[model samples]
Target: MKLAILPGLSLDEDELEITYILASGPGGQNVNKVATAAQLRFNAAGSPALSERIRVRVLELAGTRATRDGEIVITGRRFRSQQRNREDVIERLAELLREAAHRPAFRVATRPGRAARQRRLDGKAHRSGVKKNRKVRADD
Candidate 1:
């Protein structure tokens, strides 16, 4: 099965490796015994499905979740059940991939307008005058 992460990016089910571990938090006695936490690992760099640009972007967007070896590790423990946790992890991975699929908006470089600069300078001058007026006069 292939997961459609975005319009341009789709991930194969074979590329993902899933593991389950004991979850911590509110589930009472069942939490300690059941391995409900789901961890999904995907090697973004080695994937044949990703382009070089998307791979780099995915690695960048993955942040702390990504390993040095280019594997993205997503953990889900919000749900008490293993099935829900597994779905959560997969959804999280898809979200991350979706974020990486989009190109960042280019920031337009702009200098302050003449009026803005003037207003800033005027405010500074007004503040300076106010501070100057607060000082004790030598005559007083």
Candidate 2:
């Protein structure tokens, strides 16, 4: 199974390493008996599916979730069933990859227009006049 990240980018299922562990929280007796939590590990840095730029972005976006060795570790315990948790982890990973795949448009620096600048100055002047009017006169 391939995880489609973007239009032309897809990650192989073999690239993902999934392991089931004991889920924490309110599961009564089933919690101790079954390993319902899914832990997924992906080597984002070493993956051939990702380009150098995207790899860097993915690692940066992963933040604390990424280990020192460039592996992204995601744990899913939201569902009681192991299959559901596995799906959840895969979905989360896909979301992260999708985010990394998108490149933000370059922001062009712009200065305020002459009219805008004038309006700002006018507002400041009006505020100054309001403050001036509030002053107690010696005659009063």
Candidate 3:
């Protein structure tokens, strides 16, 4: 199965290693007996589906979830069912990849307009005038 992230990027199911583990918290007795949590490991750094630029962004965005080996480990235990958890992890991974695929618009450096600079200077002058007025006159 291929997971489509962006228009050009798709990840093969083989690239993902998913395992089931026992989930902690809030499942009562069922939590101990059942391994419902899904752990997904994806080698983002080594994936052929990603270009160098997208790979770097994905790893950076993964933050602490990414290992030094360039594998991104995502644990999904939000749902009680193994299938739901599996789906959750896959969706999360897709979201991460989608975000990384986006390129931010280049920001052009801009200077303040003449009117804006004048307004700022006028405000400063007004403030200076107010402070000057606060001082007591020697003649008074």
Candidate 4:
């Protein structure tokens, strides 16, 4: 599988690992028998593979996804089958990697377009006219 690399120097699969746990609630007969819930474990600090820049960024992004030990844990149990849960975990991990892959475009200074500025001024003027019309005249 192509490992997912996220914004931080950390790659999803390299830093993150998953374990299948028994799912809780409902499912009656099937609940006890199947271990379908997926638990993903990722450590933001401990990884040797991540670049210093990316690791810190990934940690910030992980937020609540992170643990005190710098581990980011995510769990999913919506699927009844273990395979689907695994796929979900993989998809989520991939998403994180996809996020990491791109450097956000920096904003270059720009001036408003003449047409857009004109439209904005026109809209504000129109709004003022509408409000003016709605006002009650004390003389009336």
Candidate 5:
């Protein structure tokens, strides 16, 4: 099984290992006879294909996906057929990798626009003028 790679990063199928286990749900004798649930294990800590930074992010993102032994585990059983479940798992795994592969876009520092600054100054000036006008004269 294979997953669609993200735009910038490419992953080989060899990096991913999938196992199909008996699905748990209604299906009569078919449920007992066939395996439908798909379990995918990817070694993020050991994969040379991914950058160390991306690898670390992957581990962080996976969280519960990793086992005590440190293998990422993703399971799928939304579909009754093993083929469909398998595809779902692969798609999900690819998405996870794509998310990890992404780096946050650089944010450009920006100051308030000229018009915005002028507006703020205008508001302050107006407020000050109001306060000045509110002062009562001694004669009044």
Candidate 6:
């Protein structure tokens, strides 16, 4: 069950480790008795399918969801059924991978223009004048 994450990237099913855990939610009698939540773990660092750059980005995008061991852990407990929860986790993983696939636009370094700098200084001077005027003159 390979997952097609982005246009050119796909992840093999073997790359994912999925487990079912008991969910803490209202699901009648089945909630306490059955494990319906799905926990999906993926090794982003060790994944052969991901390029080095994408792997690093994936780890960065994962934030707290990523463990120190470079594993991405995602939990899905929205649904009462294990199948649905599993699908939900998989969907979340795909969405995350898709986000990692896109490269950010490079930011061109810029400096404040002379006119803009002059305007800022002018505003500061005007503010200083207003504040100075607000003070009662000792001579007056």
**Span of 10 residues, lowest total lDDT, candidate 2:** 1-10
Error of 1 at 16 (Å): 1.2
| Alpha-carbon deviation at 28 in model 5, angstroms | 3.7
Error of 3 at 68 (Å): 2.2
Residue clash pairs of candidate 6: none
Taking the tens digit of each residue's C-alpha lDDT, what string does model 2 give over 23-123? Answer: 99878899999999999999997999999988999999999999999999999999989999999999999999999989999999999999999999999
Q: Candidate 1 — which residues are off by over 4 angstroms?
A: 125-140
What ranking emerges by TM-score with the best candidate at the front? Answer: 2, 3, 6, 1, 5, 4
Q: Candidate 4: where is the Cα deviation over 4 Å?
A: 1-15, 109-140
Regions of model 5 farther than 4 Å from truth: 1-4, 68-70, 121-140
| lDDT string, candidate 1, 77-123, tens digits | 99999999999999999888877778889999999999999999999
Write the residue-wise lDDT of candidate 4 on 56-137 in tens digits: 7666777788777877688889888888887787677556645544568999999999999999999999999999999999
All models, RMSD in angstroms? 2.5, 1.2, 1.5, 4.5, 4.2, 2.3
> Which regions of candidate 2 fall more than 4 Å away from where they truly are?
none
Candidate with the greatest TM-score versus the true structure: 2
Clashing pairs in 2: none
lDDT of 3 by residue, 1-140 (tens): 89988899999999999999999988899999999999999999899999999999999999999999999999999999999999999999999999999999999999999999999999999999999999999999
RMSD (CA, Å), candidate 4 to true, equals 4.5
Q: lDDT tens digits, residues 1-140, model 5?
A: 33357665676788878899988887778888898889988887787677888888888888999766656889998888988888898788778878888889999999999999999999999999999999998987
**What TM-scores do the predictions have?**
0.79, 0.93, 0.90, 0.65, 0.72, 0.81
**Candidate 6 versus the native: TM-score?**
0.81
Q: State, as a TM-score between 0 and 1, how close model 4 is to the true structure.
A: 0.65
- lDDT of model 2, residue 82: 95
Error of 3 at 99 (Å): 1.4
